[model samples]
Target chain A: MNTNFTHHQSAHCENGVASNLLKFNGIDISEPMVFGIGSGLFFFYLPLLKVNQAPAISYRPMPGFIFNKAAKRLGITVKRIKFSSPEKAQIALENNLKNNIPTGLQVGVYNLTYFPDEYRFHFNAHNLVVYGKTDNTFLISDPVMENVTTLTEAELEKVRFAKGTLSPKGQMYYPTHLPSEINWESAIKKGIKNTCSDMLAPVPIVGVAAMRYLAKSIRKWPKSKGVKVANHYLAQMIRMQEEIGTGGGGFRFIYAAFLQEAAIILKNDKLKELSFEMTQIGDLWRDFALNASRVCKNRSNVEDVYNTLADQLLHLANLEEKFFKELKKAI
Target chain B: MKKEEIPQDESNLSKSNVKELCYATDENGNYTTGLSTGWEAKTIALESSINTINERIEEAKENIKSGKASPIVYFMELHRMDWPTLADYVGLWQWRVKRHVKPSVFKKLNNKILQKYADAFQISVDELINYKGA
Candidate 1:
């Protein structure tokens, strides 16, 4: 099984897989483009949904979301399948690779031998592409890696069906048909519109509103659960921001880069300006993480820091609110 | 986010470059990363997280050694889980999981329950019952 797929390291997993699949299919879409057209920017603070015993704070949408959504927006046809058992999944993937079709998979990072030990968590939504096999090893294009790597068929099997939340269950996807051309203008408009909608979504726990929601939850932690829990909660927030694979701020930067590209393609100066503004917001987010880390580090007092952190989030939400509004009107 | 900002360093992952990424701007406003060698921020975060994990594992070890909790509790903490997460994995109620955390109840856990836990921890029942994590 040899698909001879080219591997390119990417900032984020799913977006990288989407871009690589598109490139393999001759579409040549960049990762940022896929992330943008997919409307990959999102925020959801689910205090009830615990990850590592802390409230869930996700910077982006679920795995495979960007690929599925971007393919739709670009008029590309893609096939997605999930297997009930590891045997069937392996067989299907082997057949695809034999046919020279690279397959994208969602697998748990915990069991992937090639993953850096420090980076390996119980995360099960990580995405990578499997394109070839030799002897007992499967060649994998993990977008986060610098080069192609190999996973033994046995090793691959475990990660494919790894247990815990968001189990992949052998989920795999590939582009069945990528159109020869694209309507960039309409695509850009739709992408921007959807992103604007996401940032402005009315739900209290979604969009920029979620930041405020998370801040409120942070404030409650010190009062309700005590300082230690609050510290963990804050650390988790920073992890969600800086540690977990170029998270919230990183995605924002990627989107800003996309907007910069869109500005050029659509000849819209406003998008270029928006891109700059978004970068500044990304910087603001980095600052938020820095200060929040201070509180987590126990270098700063909780009462002294929580209010500042909460206010920072409210400020970010307000900036985002206005930015998205202007973005919709600009397009 | 620019192409120029992408890190030239593709060093292997270590605790120092644990959160390695392609872009990390510096104080000089230059886009660079310690991907090849190491960066102070990445080092700190990695060490802190590892320390936290270690401290928790030590606590769990003490809890087990004192006979206040079972090995299951230790493994759960080792797996970076809370009781609710372990409960979800084993399809047991939180109360039942809490009960099972105690050595008195754990000694009486049936093969089925032990198997559920072993499956969750991805270990043999014997290993689940006996092994202390390094």
Candidate 2:
């Protein structure tokens, strides 16, 4: 591990890495501030979208959206590269570290040797910072880790070039330029306005609107595909909600936290009220995930569990709908 | 999202191994993060995933022993996937993947296809073909 690399466990990886790298470049910001100013919180329920043929239920924006958007908003120019060859990617990272610059990487989680077997999955958007190297071992600062870790160059290449499902394609990054000063007010307003629009977008498979559709669709799963398949969907949702690492309540809680921070930064009292409401909704999501897991695990045939889950989701949909509306008005 | 909800007495989570960090308090009332350790429910989920991995590894061992498949079959199983999932990874049709699952067909696969599968498993092609079950 590099003695100069400061590692602190964070709630989410992208925001964490973004925050850390920015800090290293002489900018002071918290993860929640980065997430909020970037408008990282979102709820997307796409039944037709499949990751490995499993329904994609994302609670945040896409992989690069948070960091890229956050950087753009803060007028920070980060050197982003998508390499065509693993050899070239390896050399670029080595050069950056040689220059005493910390580099950020988008890596596959499944093959990283340092990750606990339990925490490892096939996710390819995982981010970490490579700070220093001794011989062949590259010191790593995965934002989610309690301490700095190390990975061999070979192991790092394996995951950096990890294939299948959102392949990393040897992508890595480091900050290039920092604005003399940031216009926090404009950025905060823009983030809130864009998030409100995204949440309230008039579409069937997106935003708060999709939450209603997901509830309706979930209720119909048993009749359409039998109890076994319905349970499968339930299990998938639970994993999407819980096991995806750092995304508690599918990221509702983090977003609520962001809102809490935004409220203070922007000095908007209404945003604070809205933050509390969103936290309650996040808690409800946790409750729904818990209930669904119970029903699925116990093989409960009591249809009430399913009904309650649906109702809870619908309640969430309603809550978010009201939230975005009020949020738009507040701004 | 707290120790109360997570199992307190988890054997896997000794205090020294815990990761400490800050968390937002949502409102400002009860919201400071500290030397929090691993969560109980998260541990259970991890244990379950490990169980799934073990089951798949076991099944692949039997398949390898039976010579119904190449060692690549074991890596697919290690990823907790089936033929279709592997097919999806390599962009090969199900029938092609099905055929390649057999040791005979896998022997005939070209370096390109082998590379594809190796890339999917995040291992060298040789490693994919030489995986020994633990």
Candidate 3:
């Protein structure tokens, strides 16, 4: 059975899935709008939590947070479930398809056959849509892919239950009810306000403080850890920022897009100016990634190189701090 | 970045015939979406991590040959897993998983434990037991 779902590629997976799923329900929202309404931009540096042997760093909030937050703000009722058994999960998904509901799923990326090999790490929490099923293959609408694809039953189950950190455990979600009227102005204001607070959060490991904390750690890494280990950590940090479906510059450009769209809807000229400033900050982040990659590739033992990178990060933190303060005032 | 400035440098995505979606500014300074083949900075970072994994795998292989580590160590590194992650996958205690990394302790493991490790690695018991680093 096919639900006649239209596929639209997006820069990030969660935003794509959220936007596509809402569109299927007749919301006609853009991916950046969904991301903005969801308050998806975030940064966290957890030194104690080890992912792939390096301190866990995330450019976005935990998976599913964006979709859930957006749904709640828009007064949409979404059904989410996690099945203990793969068989039950399959049955639930088939039921949704039979009812003409396009289902969103949280899956591990490592065993997703359609993904490019370079992108397939053990990272779980990748989101996709399963719209139809025939014979043994399920139609897949992966947001990051240029076009829709399919996955066999066995292949789907493997990734659903891919064992590791953040194992999906056969999780599936779908919007059951969308309100008749959504107050775009209020939602937009709330989203912008929350994002400003999140970025300027008081904690050291979260938001702008976390960025500065990471800068301090980067300066220490070369001296405390050897050059090889330091390089590996830098590689991990860059991978989290640039790779893994973050659009271009760690969701900065995407947020800027949201602001531009918000500026039109709210007709706030100040927002338009801040949107441009955000784009410049996104460019700065790309510059940091480029220079940091050079340090990793050169295996540079020079401590000054790391110091330069740290200064770049500190500069970014300062810019973000001022930008968020201005954003909060504009709203 | 400007729409025209989006990097299309050849990288793994280009080799795989995949283009990633990026948000860039049009000439009007408005945000627009564009497709990029890849970026060299991202490719380098990705390759560095993969290289680190491969280096660990090679070290694990050498340790297995010297009888200092078990075949499990090789497969763990091959799968890009560490002791804690593998233990989480196999539902074993951290210390037990560490014990299973020793050549002596691994050889004494029964089929039940071997089966668990095999399932975690997505390999058969026969392959897990008989793997000789080839």
lDDT (Cα, tens digit) per residue for candidate 3, span A12-40:
99999999999988998999898899999
Docking class of 2: acceptable
Which of 1 and 3 is ahead in lDDT? 3
Candidate 3 CAPRI grade: medium
Q: Which pairs in model 2 have colliding backbones?
A: B7-B40
Best prediction by lDDT:
3
User: Candidates ranked by DockQ, best first?
Assistant: 3, 1, 2
Q: Each prediction's TM-score against the native?
A: 0.89, 0.86, 0.98
Error of 3 at A214 (Å): 0.6
Candidates sorted by TM-score, best first: 3, 1, 2
Clashing pairs for predicted structure model 3, backbone only: none
Off by over 4 Å in 2: A1-4, B1-30, B34-74, B81-95, B102-134
Candidate 2, residues B36-106: lDDT per residue as tens digits? 45444444444544555676689888888777668877888778665655786798988988788788888
Tell me the deviation in Å of residue B57 in model 2.
6.1
DockQ of 3: 0.79
Q: What lDDT does each candidate get?
A: 0.77, 0.75, 0.91
DockQ-wise, the better of 1 and 2 is 1
